[model samples]
Target: MIVSGKLLVSLSLLVLVFKVSHGQPLVPALIIFGDSVADVGNNNNRTTLVKANFPPYGRDFVNHQPTGRFCNGKLATDFTAEYLGFTSYPPAFLSQEATGMGILTGVNFASAASGYYNWTAQLWGAISLDQQLNYYNEYQSIVVNMVGEAEANAIFSGAIHLLSAGTSDFIQNYYINPFLRGYTPDQFSEILMRSYSSFIQKLYGLGARRIGVTNLPPIGCLPASITLFGSGSNQWNIKLNQDAILFNNKLNNTSQTLQKSLPGLKLVVFDIYQPLLDMITNPSDNGFFESRRACCGTGTFETSVLCNSRSVGTCNNATGYVFWDGFHPSEAANEVLAGDLLAQGIDLIS
Candidate 1:
């Protein structure tokens, strides 16, 4: 379906809210799945197959131990749960047995390096969206077994499905500028948004009625992009990124369409665009000094190659900038952006 027609627009505003006023207080339980942005270390690091579990990745984490999360501190998903009074960082589903926790405490199935496309992960093969959905199904079964229907509804009422990814899709595949899809930039994005809508619908079918979703952040602003792609005469292409803005605009439209596609589903948007947009566009307003350059680097854009080793690539000051590594955000950026999203007034569905 073409996404921008007035029919879809009218339907999205016709939301049928689920009633939680039957004497049960809504409690938050989170299930997250996506790329490095939302990953709370689901990769397991059984071998060296994961990112974020290594040094400097979690330097700000408790005890300075690496938990494989992409940010210097808690990810947006972690802080998002905390905003609702659940655990700040959702425990990984794979580690639940060791932690001895129930789903009500919030289980994170998000892997640091996973994506919706099959090609994202190389030899190790990253988690596909379908795989992530399978895990979600498993978690739902666990929830049903644990607290029974009553409390399940309470927690599930507040239970929010958080999916944050996309910058990878472009860098990894979409922006290869291939003709295999036979689509213009807008056409390709429409296909992606539709796939994403289907993914969300699948979750809704399985009973995830509340969701917080985000679009790709500014891909051109990433250190990796600049270190490699930014040095060209087109500094605007290199330094001032607009690819993410375009992708996010498409994503916002898609979210609006998805809200209309399903009845009784609450779709809350997390705008990763303007927050970083503000940072790059107006760096001083948010205390971000180094806007165009990277905190970590080696020869050029601190290309992903340089970011691998902490010994060589540490940045000057993380808080002075928005990006942490080349691709992800600093703790400050995550906090500020996530804080802005909350201020947009996300609450439990009632």
Candidate 2:
């Protein structure tokens, strides 16, 4: 009944390894689709500037090796798989580790800096949602070969599909690009929603039933956003934050409508906005000391490869910071967020 802290951690890791290495998982698998926030390592081999494959990035990960995650450690998707009884993190579909029975554990198709729009991925040469779907189609063939048709179909239908995109459409494109700057926030959100709906229906067609999609986190509070858009007036920052709220609202409504209209679909919008806002507004409440700066580089503008191994000012300790780089949450922050997500959306899959 009373387990020591060290022992508890040991037991948990052992159980996780067992679940990942053996037994039928609670959920057959998890397929992740998103931008940097949920990307594991799908961008590593791609000709993308939006990559995190070098040191200080995965400083706290297993073996202290960088695996292209935009964080100091495991992502929320990895933790979600842990809760779902996975022994190890899901492998990126493009990674060599994703072969054989490892494919049954799941695969991550999320590419950093990519988004709902194909142009978003093109901006950084990352994989677009369309490309991710194509990869999924290829994955289907792999699954059918590994297991019979009936079993493969059952695994896919029972599996949980996780999606998180759209942030880059606003952050990296609409807000900055002169061409996209013509559209109002509402108009841009609509465009993104059109893309989201298309992706969902496409997954549904591919036999996916349970899907968990994360809404945008508070973009205004991201260290990079604050550095790029923050000023004494704070007017521009307020506007971006408002756009995020508007986009999240539309996402909720669309998910609800789609779930009702699409047969056997269970689409749940994970509310990442509120919890992240809470952590930003009150960092101490979530065990974070630095809320507006990252642990790497200048803690303001550096992200992706910019927060490199040669970055002179990378912090010695990352646990007290909410962000690892200017653009992404630190491992500590990810753990808190992932715990909330698993609690909120567990029923949809389990």
Candidate 3:
């Protein structure tokens, strides 16, 4: 007997729910590394302009406290943690909560404005990918000291590691920097792929088996992207979107190769591009009222410091909007994206 794809998915979800309800989490931990999208509050203490630990940013979060997450509330990763049955979200590696028992669940090493290239992070004073890995190594040592090598290894091998980047590479660096203009989009994507491959190999060496990497979203549809590259037009920039597609394709292909080469590596490439693009192009279908502009300030291009409580015309409620700021999605949109991610990344936990 043959079963429909939808039915198979439903059955799988049922199994996951059964496991979680039995007090057995799908994974031991939810380790995260990436850019602002996955960052919980890694950049909060850093003297960088890419911070979001302020009002109007976390206005809808728990206790309405901005935790340096770029979104108005929880990020997609936060929802992923919930689905995986983790009672507490991973604390930022730089935060005080990263010490001792606080890191038993997991830790986030993501930084805002960071990319595959170290120079990209240097441009904005954000932590580089290399440095994030180094911190992870240190975290492993601390965990070993607390729980011995055997228990620590169990956590490392059983945990799900998530990596999210690339969007900032193009939007913040390649597209804007004059020095990087020499390399074509394809060449730049190749460079990023190399970095991605290296990062995965090093992570595997550190005993990470289950890995989920988020591909690029629709870069052209972002409020900040449109404002910066739209040439004063109220339309999404197709060029930047094409670049994102190119990079995502490379990411898919590279992930396949890495999985084939590395034994026991469960590398799943989470596609955020089409899901987010659908919401932007067909907002009504996704329960969103506004897609063209963000919910903050004028909605065209206000983020970070510009998207403050004092910003004029900031929307009172963000539930009806697809985006909370110029560069990040609202909590409502993040929920939808998270659902899609969990479905796509079922293998990571299974």
Candidate 4:
């Protein structure tokens, strides 16, 4: 198909902007990775097991169509882009109508159900941070092609680089303690942290200076975990959620270590640990009604059933609820989360 006059102009501008700006912000781009939480729509396209393209997933948005996003509506990353002045939460470049198309301020590299480990996909595993890296590389190539070397470099340097992952490393991956793999909790944490650190360094090498990393939230409080511990009881078992607290601490600690290693990498750790802790401890303050059971209905009443299960029923009021499914947060929750992340105004890179 012939390029439209508008796209032709967009392309020309993309190239010209790159040629002129050596290391300036072409525009900010938001790249996502990891599991359901950040998964924009990888599962929607991939035939993999880790998927969420069912109905009720997009109930809050237009058409109420499930786009395979884990949430009932917009994701935290989506709101982040909106704050930075982007149209709609940017779609996955691979999922976009045109792979070569470039938006003024954003792009989402997050693939639904992806994880750091390669085979995680087959197991319905979330996108691994490692696999997400591959996507990032793809994103770079697209940026290079669309904006040219000079402009791309400027964008990388000037644009804010948002990295939110690792939660899947705990929730989706059974290796939180790696005991199942025969490794102790400490042992597993060590290996994962090292691997994660290496990944961050690689990202820095690729020109990610302004890094916004969201630490893992309270995993134990996840609807799935609650369902498991609460059994038939609706109360969230606090003791069980401790592991999530530990993991978030580890993720945060690792971020500090990474900052020391990458002198130039401005790392801003969005302390989700404390926020989630406070929310669960005091739902009213954080704006959550039910913290344990998900609003969606499954035979089991957790998120075992996708939000839009043909047989199961969806929650009546998504906004009033905290979690949309067993694992993902509701759009209302994500909106609040986005505002929280932006509360202090990030000066990590600038």
Candidate 5:
């Protein structure tokens, strides 16, 4: 007898509820790795131009203090932590809080402008994916020392590991870099896929059982992409969107294959593309008034250093805007995205 997808999901959720009801935390922790979308403040101390630990970046966060998050407030991962009953969001691995008892919940190793390819991050002076994994290895040792081996093992195996990358690989490196342009988009995505598979396998080796990877968002719809590739027509770049779709398709297929081959691996590919595209295509339906541009600066192409306290024409509020800057989603948008992500990734916790 075959079970319907909806029934499988419902049964998985029931198991999750049972675990929680029995006093086990929904998941022991949440471990994060990837690019700017998941980076809390890892880039703040790094020698990278992609840093966002300044005014107007975290204007909606606690005390309105910038925490190096690309958004005006929390990211989708931050909301995921809240949904998982984590009182305090996981600390960045490079931050002061990633010490004794502080990192018991988990740690964020994501860096802005980083991608699956080391060169992609190297070009921007951001931490590479390999480097992020190295940091995770270091974090694992620290956790072992703090909590003893058995508990540490439990946390490592039980935590939900999240990865959100790929956008920067194409937008920040492949498309613009002359040397990388030698390879077709398919060839480049294959390279990225190899890196992705390696990273997941390494994480699995490090004891991560539950993993959730976010697929690429609508790249062509990003204000910066439109500005750079839309021929000044203020429209989505068709080729770039197609590239995103191609990468996402590969990501979904690879995730299925990994789940089948890897023992006890609960891998889920969260579809960030469609939810974001829906908001961009019909902003009013999602209670968002602006989706074509961002809330910062001119809202067309401003991001990172270009989006600052001195940015002219910056909106006072970002609640109605889908994007906070040229590349990252606003807090309101992240909240909506998080709901969708949790719904899709419930099986990971189960």
Candidate 6:
């Protein structure tokens, strides 16, 4: 079957198109791991009080359906996938939808209230960091079975692994829990760093080279933090914010160190604190009407389950507020933060 030169070229192009279409999408995949900030709905299936699969949570999402996200709509990861041209948000690894091509594309292993430290998740009955890492290993095996080893390895190496955590460690564990009381703020930050560094190294070992880890947001400004520790001179809140800054700095340093130490690694530390602080401190500048309080309930004392359907005084306009609940950012705020992340960290993957 001898073919002419033009016919041969046309056949080659057709084969290329078929291979690409049947293979990975624009951005190979987006494998997410970390805490509530990255969790899509992993916590909903868990036996944890940290679940947010209820009304007023995903109120602003497509179809206004609450899909267990902690925010009023999409999370940063959801926007990230969309920005990278994914048709849908990465499904939770535990969800039934996370199978075949979905698993091949990406999966979210993060759990609400989880953190770098397992103890933080244990406190709230959420999936721990160790467990999430195990889930990634599970995902790798599934993808290999679906697409074969060589192609699966390519997707794994090219994928963007988004990790967001440390909030629960500081707010839900070290700050409030008396059980972990011995460590001072500085010592606690170091503790979290050790785990964080290990997590990145472990991911690299698992073939994740393109990684973007979100730093701690300004914890002092969160409505929940303000309500819990903003009384009196706000010394506790001040201390917490300072701790958060210090930890973020350390995280940045860790990224640099890991990049140098690990071969073919592209790790970026997303500075969420500055952008989020700007939105909270200068709400009008960010087109947000409310910064000091959330849109749910009284805006200062409600979060997670507390920001439920029966919660009175839930704001009609989630877009006008910085936070949807006392702790989580509104969907509008997530979009802004996601934009910042894409701008700052796209190079790492590209």
Candidate 2 lDDT over 229-348, as tens digits, reads: 887542228777899999999999999889989999988899988898888889999988888778998898799878998998889999999888988988898899887786667456
Per-residue lDDT of candidate 5, residues 1-350 (tens digit): 99998888778767765655666468889999999999999999888899899989999999999998999999999999887877789999999878777689889999999999999999999999999999999999988888799999999999999999999999999989999868999999999999999999999999999999999999999998999999989999989999999999999888888899999999999999999999999999999999988999999988889999999999988999999999999999999999889789977875
Write candidate 6's Cα lDDT for 82-132 as tens digits: 767677778999888787676777899999999988899988999999899
Q: Name the better of 1 and 6 by lDDT.
A: 6
lDDT measured at residue 176 in model 3 versus the true structure, 0 to 100: 88
lDDT of candidate 6 at residue 178, scale 0 to 100: 85
Pick by TM-score: which candidate is best? 3
Evaluate candidate 1 by giving its C-alpha RMSD to the native, one decimal.
Answer: 6.8
Evaluated at residue 213, the lDDT of candidate 4 is: 70
- All candidates' lDDT scores? 0.65, 0.87, 0.92, 0.65, 0.92, 0.86
List, residue by residue over 173-237, the lDDT tens digit for candidate 4: 55433544675545556666677677778888888877777766776677776666566676665
What ranges in model 3 sit over 4 Å off?
none
- Write candidate 3's Cα lDDT for 173-234 as tens digits: 99989999899999999999999999999999999999999999999999988998999998
What stretches of model 5 exceed 4 Å from their correct place? 1-24
Q: What is the clash tally of candidate 3?
A: 0
TM-score of each: 0.82, 0.92, 0.98, 0.82, 0.95, 0.91
Error of 6 at 217 (Å): 0.4
Clash count, one per candidate: 4, 2, 0, 14, 0, 0
List of clashing residue pairs for candidate 2: 16-87, 20-87
Clashes of 5: 0
- lDDT measured at residue 44 in model 1 versus the true structure, 0 to 100: 59
Give the distance in Å from residue 19's predicted Cα in candidate 4 to where it truly belongs: 26
- The TM-score between candidate 4 and the true structure equals 0.82
TM-score of 2: 0.92
